[model samples]
Target: MNLGCIVGLKEWIVPQDKAFFDLFEQMADTVNEGAVFLNVIINNYVDVQNQCHKMKQIEHQGDLIAHQVYEQLNRTFITPLEPEEISRLATALDDILDYIDGTTQQMYGYGVTETDDFMKELARLILLSTQEVQTAVRLIRKLDDPRAVEQHCIEINRLENLADVVLGNAIKSLFATNDAITIIKLKDIYENLEVATDKCEDVANVLSDIAIRHS
Candidate 1:
């Protein structure tokens, strides 16, 4: 085989598009929606119980998409991607929304009356990361520009790093306060938001690996 043949190769074989790739896109879409809804809560900071309940509904939507991916995987013998890749991607995407919903749950359960700057910034990062993840997922479908997918993955990693820094500073600020109970509540919220970004990075890693393998 010549260099041109290898260089001109497409992104993926995609043996079963509907069974895997389409479902992956659906999962990514739901995750991004959940992140956006979380940002809504972060910005508005009103109707604690109501916002939490609404976020839970969005998370449930994500759950249904994830279940479709898993069920399709079990039924399909030949998949667009590797079986493990299909399963890993589905779970990773689901995890992001799970954390988003979980953080809102904590806010309501902890009786958080308001939001803080740190939490807002972290939620913003989570939103950015999830958007990147969705982009990468879509790119994988056609692999039109594998380089573009890699670039988006790089951005996701950068956002996750920023989330880490935000979490660190938020924790430091919390400790400065004398109210240990308040400190604990806010710290947990910050950590959950941070983890959502972490899951975004995980999705990025998987996308990068898939890109490289088929590049």
Candidate 2:
């Protein structure tokens, strides 16, 4: 059967399944908004905490959609792509939300009140990564043009690397400071941000693999 027929069958049989992509879009929007909020009110710990909590809920919803997609893909054989590929893509998309949620949780748990330049830069990198992820996901349903996917993966990788540098500098600055408690809190936040970046790279890697395999 053709791709359209398969997708049509999926839609007819699985009513909730169609919402997976929409959830991903919501996840991207939440992350983007959270990043902007963090940048704008980095000094307001309470505001940051509230936004993080909101992000956590959004991420959890995204995770639920990913789980539903995974389960549905397992039961259905006539997928648009290999079952393994679909699983990988779903998992990667969920992973982004996981990282975003975890990062926000740490930001609150650490009671981080002040934002440094490095933290601002890290937030910006996260915004860029999520935007790239959104673009990549939009192309996954198309899958005809590997070139666009490749380009997105490249951009995601670059943003992830930039985040890595920011994380390193933040850590260095944390150590350079004499406040032990502050250093500890900031270190935890930095680590969580770094993990989020790594998750973005994971999404890119999955996209790259799909592109290469299908090309």
Residue 99 of model 2: what lDDT?
A: 66
Alpha-carbon lDDT, every model: 0.87, 0.72
Per-model TM values vs. the true structure: 0.91, 0.81
Name the candidate that leads on lDDT. 1
* Model 1 residue 188 distance off true place after TM-score fit, in angstroms: 0.7
Residue 208 of model 1 has an lDDT of 86
lDDT for model 2 = 0.72
Tens digit of per-residue lDDT, candidate 1, span 1-215: 88876644432332557557877888888898888988899899888898889889989988998899888777665676778887888889999999999999999899888898998999999988988898899999877688999999999999999999999999998999899999889988999999999999999988988888777
TM-score of model 1 vs. true structure: 0.91
Predicted structure 1: lDDT: 0.87
Error of 1 at 147 (Å): 1.5
What is the Å distance of residue 192 in model 2 from its true position? 1.3
